[model samples]
Target: MVYRHLNEKDRFYIEQRLSEGDSLRSIARALGFSPSTISREIKRHTPIDFKGLYCHRLTSRCAQEKRANAKQGQAFRQISEEAKMLIHQRLSTHTSDQATLFRTNKLQ
Candidate 1:
């Protein structure tokens, strides 16, 4: 599937499934995502004071607020630690580079 972020409807579904006592794996299956994705979504949006609680509306609002507050490059062109090291030890990273350095190390 093409990569896309979760939306309010998805969050609402997640909230509903969670309220109905569904497992994260099951929820992920129904939503076409990995169990870890569902788990991380829950953990990411859970209210700290409530520990395990997730509210879709609040999550939506928070997400909007975050987007509105986001700064440029906060989500793009993030050089990896290995990439950073390559720059200091080797040279700046860029497109059309030789295969000698900056091979795909891995992703987080």
Candidate 2:
């Protein structure tokens, strides 16, 4: 399924459910998402101060920033640490010019 940003309605619902002491799992089931997803949505859209009080505006702004940052990178560029080390080692060995080009493309 394609991912989409949450609308104000969804945010409002999250706030409402949280305020009502609903568990993350319950909220997730209600919204047809995974529990971890619901938890992360709350954390992303509900930044808390040192005192741990949620600020809706700040949370929304954070969510906007996250979305903007995500758009800057290609999804498939994500690589594991071991894979990264292997790539670096291969580059050091200079086995293939095409490998270097592919690595450079990923860096960009």
Count of clashing pairs, candidate 2: 0
Instruction: Compute the lDDT for candidate 1.
Output: 0.76
Clashing pairs in 1: none
TM-score against native, each model: 0.61, 0.54
Where does model 1 exceed 4 Å of error? 73-108
How does candidate 2 score on lDDT? 0.70
Name the TM-score of candidate 1.
0.61
User: Which candidate achieves the best lDDT against the true structure?
Assistant: 1
For residues 1-108, what per-residue lDDT tens digits would candidate 2 score against the true structure?
877666666667777787788887887788777888877776656545525445456667778888788877675377666566767888789759787657756765
